[model samples]
Target chain A: AQSVTQLDSHVSVSEGTPVLLRCNYSSSYSPSLFWYVQHPNKGLQLLLKYTSAATLVKGINGFEAEFKKSETSFHLTKPSAHMSDAAEYFCVVPPNRDDKIIFGKGTRLHILP
Target chain B: EAGVAQSPRYKIIEKRQSVAFWCNPISGHATLYWYQQILGQGPKLLIQFQNNGVVDDSQLPKDRFSAERLKGVDSTLKIQPAKLEDSAVYLCASSLGLPGPETQYFGPGTRLLVL
Candidate 1:
């Protein structure tokens, strides 16, 4: 069995400041992790994914995530948060390779100017 | 390079009423998924189809929820007598194939409000 836990329900960051969203996972098999961003009434946009190849993964719009196996964590980060970066972010874990992608409750990022 | 598409972006109905949502996956994509996302929650898998065959439906409420993929390209999800708790966003996603590790493209989703 596999599951994901997003530590924070919401995060607030000032524009041009750094941003971090924490996620942890538990899986019996090799885990495939992903970070997705969803704007209001928009579809989920893939931010980044970790498939065992690289520990640090970069995605669109200056977003990135690091997959730490020892820590059992995949946390998303951005050097500078933009005003448009405000959105709901989800951490996903596909445990068994089927289409059963388990999602985190979601963290709503608030960008303060 | 068209992405996944879903129709009936919003729906409002009273309890015990039935509703259906449609989805069209990306071209040449063989895997399709339907997910239910309650407010403040993540998307939960409702059903998955691989080229017209069901891959998984364990989380689906079999009593009232039914889904099918016709011709392996388009799919539909139906809920008869939807309950108040069923009010949520129905998201449709599609990927390339099994053993995933592949990015699943998602649709805008259908927001259902059951009163």
Candidate 2:
């Protein structure tokens, strides 16, 4: 009953430019949201999480996401992009009190120097 | 602390061949999960184990796929008579059995290619 949709499959940005990866969700109850990054040939790393405590959440590597309940959105953003920031990003949502976590199709961030 | 560990970073076999992937979770973590990630898609949960007991496996293809966490520390996922569609990255993740909002730590994943 809970799912996540990533608006973009791929995004390209020049170095030092702002970056945004959009996501929308459908859940019956208040859900926990997370942003994870995966570098090539590497495992997924947690960027940040929202557990209903805060609407705006900051994460590692100058990344952050804002949880908008009214919009049913949790969009990841960064003020400036770096070469190392190029990776695949995923938006995740876990149904309330459920063990299964649903993930979006993912957005690949491309950094152009 | 060490992260989740998986074996056979890459594997290739014929469509009818069988393959197995292994995983070792972080110390003392009570939950382990197996996920299949196809190209350009997010990882999908194949099975979940809570301390050597099956918690959820609705998505697993039981006729061809099976998994087990015998000792609750390490786990294995096997695919028999594999199909081309089964070619994907098998990721292993583990997490503490906290009540809610637990972070699942992932492994580098085993990439399987069925030709």
Candidate No. with top lDDT? 2
List lDDT for all candidates, in order. 0.91, 0.92
- Model 2 alpha-carbon drift over 4 Å, by segment: none
Please give the lDDT score at residue A75 for candidate 2.
Answer: 96
User: Worst lDDT window (10 residues) for model 2 chain A?
Assistant: A95-104
- DockQ by candidate, in order: 0.68, 0.66
Per-residue lDDT of candidate 1, residues B47-93 (tens digit): 88889999889999999999999899999999998999999999999
Clashing pairs in 1: none
lDDT of 2 by residue, A14-107 (tens): 9999999999988898888889999998999889988899899999999999999999999999999999999999998886566567777999
Candidate 2 Cα deviation (angstroms), residue A94: 0.7
lDDT of 2 by residue, B1-79 (tens): 9999999999999999999999999999999999999999999999999999999899999999999988889999999
Scored by lDDT, model 2 comes in at 0.92
Q: Interface Cα RMSD for candidate 1?
A: 1.8
Clashes in model 2: which pairs?
A: none
Candidate with best TM-score: 2
